[model samples]
Target: MSLPAPLDQIAVRRAVEAALAEDLGRAGDITSAATIPGSAAARVVIAARQPGRLAGLQLAAAAFQALDPAISFEPEVEDGARLGPGDVIARIVGPARAVLSAERTALNFLGHLSGVATETARYADLIAHTRARICCTRKTTPGLRIFEKYAVRCGGGSNHRFGLDDAILIKDNHIAVAGGIEAALRGAKASAGHLVKIEIEVDTLDQLDRVIREGADVVLLDNMPPPILREAVMRIGGRMLAEASGNVSLDTVAAIAETGVDLISVGRITHSAATLDLGLDIALG
Candidate 1:
């Protein structure tokens, strides 16, 4: 399926504005103002310094437009497209000061989000031979969860619960607080609406059995090794969706996918992915 359109423009603009405000501060771009003339116009190219999948192209453009509405920002490739080293992603032409001022903020969003997409793509590609799908957990940057999850989709991965309100996910802590797995699932079923699917986390095969008997919509197999995951999948017997999570990495995801789990959720895709290498270089006239 096609990925959803870029995030809400108004929200994007608000985020860009907040980033610019934090960056410019009360002094503004002193270096650019001191070194460049306000009327000077220049063209700059946004290029990837290393190879990776792309994301956040629209956010980068929004940063420039927020700074200078007249700035001409054009993207050569769309988000989710792969890039090689030295590939030009976009070109910007505008007042030299505006271009220089917006450079860091634009790249901050673009590179970081592209990193998320790239990491997600790596995980998705590693497990393509199986029926399992890669998904991202809620371990995302505090204010950027929506943007990061969108990047996951751009990379051919799926998103788990968007927020606590989106679904009923009974984790270990919830189980302990509510008494046990059966209690948590029963409470969730009693409290949640019929439309909301109930998913409970289980660490052992026994817990998995109880979850199945409790009639949950989905069961999360947390921290299960491939062998246990295989057994859990067999024991589940198509009764409910099975999700495997915890310690998921490029090195081990393929093995986990081979266990026949329905979904594999990785937290590091958004939480720990390194920013992709991208740079804004002034184009020679």
Candidate 2:
């Protein structure tokens, strides 16, 4: 499969700038400045300390380039490429002080984003046998939603709504406040433009029937077990798309996919993914 496009360069650069500012502060890497001569130059390799998928190579490169325009940042692999322990991701050669100052911020972006990609790949691989496509929810970091979503795509999963305005997804509370699913869907359909598709969440097969009757474009099946999900999919019968959500984990996702749902939305890939272990070491010359 073709990989998704990288994030906008301007946005990535802005994020890297902010991260570098946060790390540098007013004093600005006093340790490196005190030890390394301003004229000193070194070559370093950013290597993976554990096996995982790669993401955010551009962001890491941008971090170093922002710090020192003369630095040469060369990536060995693409963002979605799988990696093994001790694999060199990229090579950086520049003034030692600038490289050391940019090191932590670059690795932070790389490790965190690669972690999200790695987790997404795991979920995508588990459900590869079925028609269900792995998706990521909007539960992402505050300022990093776009970047995190990009990471999800890099790991072979699809993105959900990018924000509240992207689509109308009526959840349980919306239904509760709007009186019922029918009313909520009606309001959404009426308010949304002709191009906008309406999706509603339902907790049971009865609600599924109501959604089908009300002509929702998609139905989110919340917390349904595999058997119940199978029954729901059978009832749906391709009239509308079915999306499975809630408590999704690697152990349970395969069963959910086998039930024939069209989408499985998981929140943990971004919210709870463990950072991939990566380290940058100065190459001996």
lDDT of 1 at 210: 85
Q: List the residue pairs that clash in candidate 1.
A: none
Tens digit per residue, CA lDDT, model 1, 121-188: 99999998999999999999988988999999888899999999989999899999999988898889
TM-score of 2: 0.98
For model 2, where is the 10-residue window of minimal lDDT?
1-10
Clashing pairs in 2: none
Candidate 2, residue 10: how far the Cα is off, in Å: 1.8
Best by TM-score: 2
**Residue lDDT tens for model 2, 113-185:** 9999999999999999999999999899999999899999989999999999989999999999999988898
All candidates' TM-scores? 0.97, 0.98
